[model samples]
Target: MPKITYITFDETQYDVEAKEGATVMETAIKNGVPGIEAECGGACSCATCHVYVDEAWAEKTGEPGAMEEDMLDFAQDADERSRLSCQIKVTDELDGLVVRIPESQA
Candidate 1:
């Protein structure tokens, strides 16, 4: 498992272990990270799982796929670092990764 830390806009943080092959959103929802609704069950149909990848992890995570890129269009306050949590698959190399949750989702 990888330790992923979700940092809220208000500075609150929730750290959870994410198993390989599970999406980041799955670890988040499982650990009660506030703000990521994952309303579509990570099917890429909803924009509720929005998150801002920490600058350090952005390059490692790579660019979003076409579907995630399109769904990001509907997210609140999407930016260059914005990503749908469902698109981030967990991996051991992602240990200690940090992501920031937007206020809009809270």
Candidate 2:
């Protein structure tokens, strides 16, 4: 399992172990991490699962596809590092990934 850290706008953080194939949003919801509503349930239709990839981990998390980028427009505070957690699949390389949840999702 890969260990992922989710940092909230309030500065609170939750570190959870996730299966390699699970999406970041899935791991978050399973662990009851706040700030990720995931309203679209892993579909690329909603931006409720928006999160900011920590600067150091941004490149590793990769860029979003066209559909996901479109949905991000609806997310508050969307920026270059912004991503839909539901679209980020967990992998061994992401073992120590850190993502910050926006205040809007709070």
Candidate 3:
């Protein structure tokens, strides 16, 4: 399992262990992290799981797919680093990854 760090808009941090192949949104929810509201589950149709990948971990997390990109338009503060946590798969390479949850989702 890879440990992912989720930081809320207010700077509260939750470090959770993510199973390989599970999405970041799933990991957050499993750990009771408060910011991610994965309304559509792991489906890419909703942007409720929006999060900002820390700059240092961006490349490792990779870019969003076309469908995910389209859905991100509904997210608040969508930016180069913005991604739906449900779209991010956990892997050993993502250990120690840092993601920031937006205030809008809180």
For each candidate in the order shown, give its overall lDDT on alpha carbons. 0.93, 0.94, 0.93
Writing each residue's lDDT as its tens digit, candidate 2 over 1-106 gives 8999999999998999999999999999999999889887889888999999999998898999999999999999999999999999999999999999999889
Candidate 3, after superposition: displacement of residue 38 in Å?
0.6
The pairs that clash in candidate 3 are none
Q: In angstroms, how far off is 91's CA in candidate 3?
A: 0.3
- Model 1 C-alpha lDDT per residue in residues 27-52, reported as the tens digit of each score: 89988899999999999989899999
TM-score of every prediction relative to native: 0.97, 0.98, 0.97
Winning candidate number (lDDT): 2
**Candidate 3 per-residue C-alpha lDDT over 1-106 given as tens digits, one digit per residue, 9 for 90 to 100:** 7999999999998988899999999999999999788988889887999999999999999999999999999998999999999999999999999999999888
Error of 1 at 60 (Å): 0.9
The lDDT, on a scale of 0 to 1, for candidate 2 is: 0.94
Q: List pairs with backbone clashes in candidate 1.
A: none
Clashes (N, CA, C under 3 Å) per candidate: 0, 0, 0
Error of 3 at 31 (Å): 0.8
Model 2, residue 71: C-alpha shift (Å): 0.4
